[model samples]
Every structure is written in C-alpha cells, then in structure tokens.
Target: MYAQCPDCLTVFSMDAETLAQARGHVVCGHCETEFDALASLSSQLPPEPFQQLPEHKSSGRPPQVESAVYRPRQESALAADSGTTPAAESEDFSHLVFSPRFARPAHQNRMRRWPWVLACLVLLLLLCAQLAWAKRDALVVDPTAGTLLRQACNSLGCRLPLVQDVQHLRLLARDVQAHPSVPGALLISATVRNDADFDQPWPVVVVTLSDVDGKHVAMRRLRPSEYLGDGFALQRGLPSGTSTALVLEVEDPGNKAVAFEFSFE
Candidate 1:
C-alpha cells in the first residue's frame, strides 16, 4: 500500500505485514519523521489482505487514484508495548476522512455578521442626532419643534430659543424735551414699531443723551416693564406691524441734553 507523509508530502510503498508489525506507525524514508502510515494510505490499493501472489502486468484495466478513509481498529501489541491507547490512535486518524456533519454551515456564518450590522445601525442613529443638534436654531421656529424643545429644556433645566425674527423691531419716532411736572428733569418720548409679520418678544431700549459736543452725558437702559408698564403683559409678546409709545423721565445731566440717540437691542 502507498503511504504519504503529512509533513514532507512524500509517497512510498510498504508491505502490509510490515505496517501491521509497526502498528500502522512508520518513519518516512525521505524526511525521517515518524507518522501513522494508515492515516495517509491511498485508496488505489486492493482492500483484501496481502498474501503470496505472482507479479503480473495489467494491459486493459486502468489504475484508480482515490483517497483512503480510515476506521478505528483494536489496539495492537506494538502500540501497547509503547504505552499508547486506542483513543490516541483514533484521534491520530481522525483527519483521514471528511464528514458533512463536521463542516460549518452557511447560515452560521451569516449569524456572525449580526454584531457588525448592529454597530452600523447605532452609528447611523448617532449621525442623525448630530445633524439635528447642528440645525437646532433653524428648527426652533416650528410650533411642534418649539414645544419639544421647551419640554426638553424644562426637564434639563436649560433655556430654549422658542422664537425667531424677533430682531426686526424698528425705530420710528423720537422726541426729547424737559419734564413738565418735575423741575430740572428731562422727558424722553419715543415710538417703536415692529415691521415683522409675526408677534415677537420685546427688546431692551437704550437711550443716550448727548451734550452740544456730541459727548454722551447720561445713558439709561429701559426694559419692557419700564416702557410698556403693567398695562401690556410682557410675556404676551409684541404685536407685529404695530407701534408703541414710550415716555421716560430722567434727571438733568447739568449740561444741555441735546442730540439724544435711541436704539433697541
């Protein structure tokens, strides 16, 4: 029978009697390494026991080259003398045959991709959240988005920008004169208008009183409560395209209060 070496891949022939004497273990002639000869035996050999026979040449039949499949056998005396067991011998020959049961299935390989798929999905969700955070200012004007932002701000204890286009408040008219009731006091009158088509929050009005030289003498910042008074609810916001009158009395800065400027911030 022909035996091939697993280490050096050398093929050689040995008598079945000699192989049996060695307990299916033999040293390779080419590489001088010991291996189980029965594990590497070729299938081309006859299946019957080797016996005395005359050598002859075959003219018609072609040789069949096939792989050998190993089956477990009883422990031989040579293996027992060497302190080897049948379990060890069976393990040594386990690589001789290929079985469908021992092979991994395709579905099991597909299951291994689940973790990567889950990771990609989580990454996509994080990307969407980042985009929403970047566009938060533009989205805050929507009614539903404003409500959601307010609710989240309430829970998180953060401030929410619920309105947009509130900076459209325009300056309309201004009149500065001396106070009628108080002595040596000046009265400032102004009319502010909101040109925007939407109701918006009020802004802080800044008044700077300048002398004849254009140098500021007195400056005061008026809030919505000071100008609109308790009559109009400040939280109710300012109406669009409407005008409001403001009257403020301030102490005379001693120098002539001239060239006063009014601004809303």
Candidate 2:
C-alpha cells in the first residue's frame, strides 16, 4: 500500500492490485522521476482489493491503471502454500541492505565527536592548573621545581614568588670592627642562617647600631639587590639550613657603638 521513491524519498499509497498491475514501477509526482517503487517499499502490507476507504483531497490525480497483471511464480506459490514466507523481508535488521541516502556518513560522525574530545582535554588541563596553583608555595622551594618554573615564567611573562616569613632567618653571629683603610668608618659583620626545611627569598635585614644606653645611633636596611652578590648561584632564593655572611662598611655615628640589633623584615 505504501511505497517510497529511492531517489527523492517521497511516499505514496496504492492498492495491492494496482501495485501488482504496475509491476512495482511508478512515477513520483514530487520529482517526476520514473523508478522501481518496490526498491524503497516499506513493511506495510497492502489493503485488500475490496476494502474501500473515505476519500480525501489529494495533490494530484491517482496513478494511471496498468494493463498487465502480476502473479507469483510456481516456487513462490508452493512456499506460500506451505505456510512459509520468504526470509528476505524478515532477515536481521543489522544486516539489512541500505540505500545511499539512508546510510549515515562515517566522517560526519567522526567530526561531531571532536568538539567533545577537545572540551574534555581542556577541562583536564584546567584541573591540572588548579592543582598546581594550590601547591605553588611548596613547589617553589624545590630546586628542580624552581628551575622548571623559571623556564616557564620566562616565556609566559609571569613573576616568581620571592618573599617568605622573615622570622625563619636567624642571626648566628654579629660583630663590628674599625675599617683600617677608611678612618671614622665601621665595618659590620654578621652571619644569618635559614632554619626552614625549604628555600626562601632573602629578607631585608634591618641593623640598628646603638650606644651604651641602648639608644639607636645609626640605622640601615639592607635590600636583596644589595646583599645577593655575584657569587650566589641559586636564582630563586636562599637554600634552607644554610648561612651567608653579611659585610657592610658605613660611617660611624658620633656616639659610641656599644651594642647592635638585627631584625629581618
């Protein structure tokens, strides 16, 4: 009763008798192409010749009546009489034959999957970045980590962490001596050590030279650029559990320099 055009995919309804008379050949009204109607036929059975349905408006006149009559061959008749139908119509759908228009294109499916795969990769990278940010403080101290970060920061234009808790810097020794080369000038010497388990940035050392009465006579604040000499190798900061000697020559205040206080800022 129902058949489709293989080329244009247009559906039309006709009686079994009419289909049999036409031998499955019909003209499509939509595309005006003559093709074998049975090639695109659906599974719906034809209505009995005597069955009459209500009439409705149509786009075109009904198909012309055909002159010839179609009949089953002897073997087909024998199989039908034996209550067995042909397996072609009832075969496994997975192995069913498909026309060109009905089959899905493999490349289209592959193209559609790429965006989701790319999105998943982006999310994975973002997760890794969040994790790295969470552990930045701990990673900065590792010598190997510092090297890697420096290389990455150089290209990406990012700044490295350069300061830590100044309380970790301990004053090991301190002494002041007269500068032999320059009169009225005092040479200050101090030993500072890092006590933390990891490396940290150099802190500003504030030295206050005081008199016997404990009154501050001269004060000086040393910055990182002033303290880190050319001999220092570790670019990031000072290594943990290590000591560095600080030497400074400055003018002696008029009052006696009996005591000194060192504070790391």
List model 2 lDDT by residue over 1-265, tens digit each.
4676656766676545556678978888999988776655654534655232322335487778778655445656777889986555533434433334323578877788899999999999999989988888767656688668867887999767654867778889988888889999888888989887566787787879888888888898888677667545436677678998888777877657788888988
What are the TM-scores, per candidate, against the unseen true structure?
0.41, 0.50
**Top-lDDT candidate index:** 2
lDDT by residue for model 1 (66-139), tens: 88655455567666888875554345642343324324467876788799999999999999889978887666
| TM-score of model 1 vs. true structure | 0.41
> After TM-score superposition, what is the CA distance of residue 214 in candidate 2 from its true location, in Å?
2.1
Give the range where candidate 1 is weakest over 10 consecutive residues by summed lDDT: 93-102
Candidate 2's displacement at residue 133, Å, is 4.6
Error of 2 at 262 (Å): 0.7
Query: Candidate 2's error at 249, in angstroms?
Result: 1.8
Which stretches of model 2 miss by more than 4 angstroms? Answer: 1-111, 127-135, 138-163, 231-236
